[model samples]
Target: MTVTASARAASPLLDLVRPARPTHVVDVGANPIDGDPPYRGMLAAGLCRVTGFEPQPDALDELKRRKGPHETYLPDALGDGGTHTLHVAATSGMTSLFRPDTNRLGLFNGFSEWGRVREEVQISTRRLDDVEEVDAFDLLKIDIQGAELMVFEGGRRKLAEAVAVHTEVSFVPLYENQPVFGDVDQELRGQGFIPHAFAAVKRWPIAPVVFGGDFRQARHQLLEADVVYVRDFGHPESMTDEQLKQLALVAHHVYDSTDLAYHCLSQLSLRGLAVPDAPNRFLAVLGSANRT
Candidate 1:
């Protein structure tokens, strides 16, 4: 008997059964090009789905055109279903629901250009729960400038189904009345997620001019970072077999969490959901990557 290609591809982390439900990823405030969304990587691994929400019409058109067979792009903002003003910045990355603090912007070099508001456009938003398509997901990636809390507030129903999360966090408030990392940490903790890893740590020094005004050299201030949160990390045995697989995938590719992925494999092995040799293969791959 010949071994099928997909069955050959199946492993403890990802089982390539022909019709097994694809892992789902939901992205809010998604700019496909700018932030290098991790969901893109997951989707490329095959047998996965990605749904991205970007309010900007121009970006939405391009996203729609580039969407894959298992990917979707929605031209709507994620929020609590109400009207809000989007402060469009001279530098598009700074666009957000909250206004930039001019006083704070003036203190930083080149940051004034980043925070300079080019336009203000009033737009209505809706909760992710309002959309029937978002029934459940394995991972949720959000990057909506400083409105991370609002996205979670509106998508609480969908969020409950998520096993892991990756979102941008600010150590200090860049926008007026924006909640800092503390609020986001508390919120995710309340929702049953534990901080697992930190990525893209950005720092801004209090006095940049001292070191030739190059903020990169001055790592005095922790400005922003992307944090990875996992559900049921303390108790992997609590997760379903499918959830374990999803967590393993994200941890392996995005977080480089070899141990956590191994733990998930071990749990799956105990439940007989995965092959006995999965953990060994996983460790070997991790070791190979580290060597290079």
Candidate 2:
């Protein structure tokens, strides 16, 4: 499936933009039932059959303990879908599907900059293409830190099998010398995926204001949230160009304040830029909007 720029402008995620509802979802980097994993919002949305993959011992355990019949927990990393050495951070749960390096930390604003604690583990990897006769996915969310590119490469078959994808595209290099946005963008586009870059929030105060009184702070455009890739299936193409522009405008406007800011900052920081507001609040808004 391929997402068009027109569809991205107006729709929520690519899955939401499609004419049909997404029933099946695969959430990678799912927040642990005990510790923080990732993508808690997707689970709350009541997706049918979720398969979460985590490499951290504690987080993986929590995932297993909480996984019901509708959910499956895997302790392996999604690599080029084969056996590969995983660099388990001294912090454990911060395991990277690819080798750890300093450049990636730059993209994430030093989030994983603990400088690789002296501990390491050899974890197995699985390629999505290796799996036989798997069901189609409605939505696939991946946030494997710097390992996103590897997973995509291994999941080429699966990528074609899915309708929509929500991936964390960090321009940060996983290793000292690895390609980032430019490479992934080309790869995804080549695979017939339309990519939507998440936006960032603009600076605005949070003080409550009276509705019809003297409201000084009307919500202005803040940020872009997630870059969604939609396949060409199920999108309405007969809309006017003006309608498409409006749709894109509204879609960008919908990202939550803080989360959008965080996404924006993550993208910009790679180039050594700063966001105008509180990073926490910025990420929070985008996170909330993605939920909505």
Candidate 3:
């Protein structure tokens, strides 16, 4: 059996199962053409429109080269309103908005070997408080390496504006002075975001994890898979059963390997759908179909 191929492959059955889930997303740490081409097809489905921000010159250029309709690009880092120079990492993937020591804390050490250590390059920053308007956002992904907190601090108002948040978290110290998971989680919760779900580490959907939990085992990883958070949106406990199921489906994809219960509970805020009585019924159907 094969994974069902659909227009929205990361979430296929979801649209058919429940077509109302918000698809507009904002990607914070979009690296050029790196990992997942961050916002490509989402724009195609008429379910997306995104503002992708990246600080590295090369990556920013690549983002420009690869952009299309419904997508906008910003060459600034997301943080409090100010100007700051970033210590650009030698390599593209390694390039971050922070100091080099932080790279050493991540699970991958390849950046340490790339070797070019340079002075801070001037970059403009923005605070979310300064953001006068954000119409709506279904999802907001923040992967700005170790400076995620700075972005979070600046985007306090925008955080409240979004429906869900996806930020990468490294349990170990990847940067010399970056906050740990505890700090990040507290910051998220402070802004009314809850740890909605988890996604495992993978370059793409095609690359499966053959080993056990990398986040649980990797020594100094830059980021484990992205951690997702959902906004309470003033009605934390209000959701239809179908919306709950749809959310569970997303949770399954996010933390694809984790238990089903978490996958189900994560969709606590979905708007219009019925809650199926026996949650496992749909799971059993999908599971049995996969075996065929």
Badly placed stretches (over 4 Å) of model 3 are 1-22, 32-34, 37-41, 102-109, 132-134, 202-225, 232-292
* Residue-level lDDT tens digits of model 1 in 1-292: 1223552263334541112356778888777656567665656656467888899887788778877777788888888788999999987788899999987776665678788998999999888889776767888888888888987877777777778989899987888999899999999998889998886787775633646655546546787898989986777756666777777776766666879888877777777777787788777755675698
| Of candidates 3 and 1, the better by TM-score | 1
Q: Would you give me the overall lDDT of model 3?
A: 0.57
Instruction: Report, for every candidate in turn, its global Cα lDDT versus the true structure.
Output: 0.76, 0.51, 0.57
Ranking by lDDT: 1, 3, 2
TM-score of 1: 0.88
lDDT, candidate 3, 144-221, per-residue tens: 767788888877765565556777786755456767778889998887777766644533111122235442333322
TM-score against native, each model: 0.88, 0.56, 0.66
lDDT of 1 at 209: 65
Candidate 1 segments whose C-alpha is farther than 4 A from its true place: 1-12, 16-20, 33-35, 207-217, 285-292
Best by TM-score: 1
How much does candidate 3 score in TM-score?
0.66
Ranking by TM-score: 1, 3, 2
User: Residues 59-144, candidate 2, lDDT per residue (tens digit)?
Assistant: 88877887765577666666675565666666554566556665444333233554474665566677766655335555577766
State which candidate has the highest lDDT.
1
Worst 10 residues of 2 by lDDT: 242-251
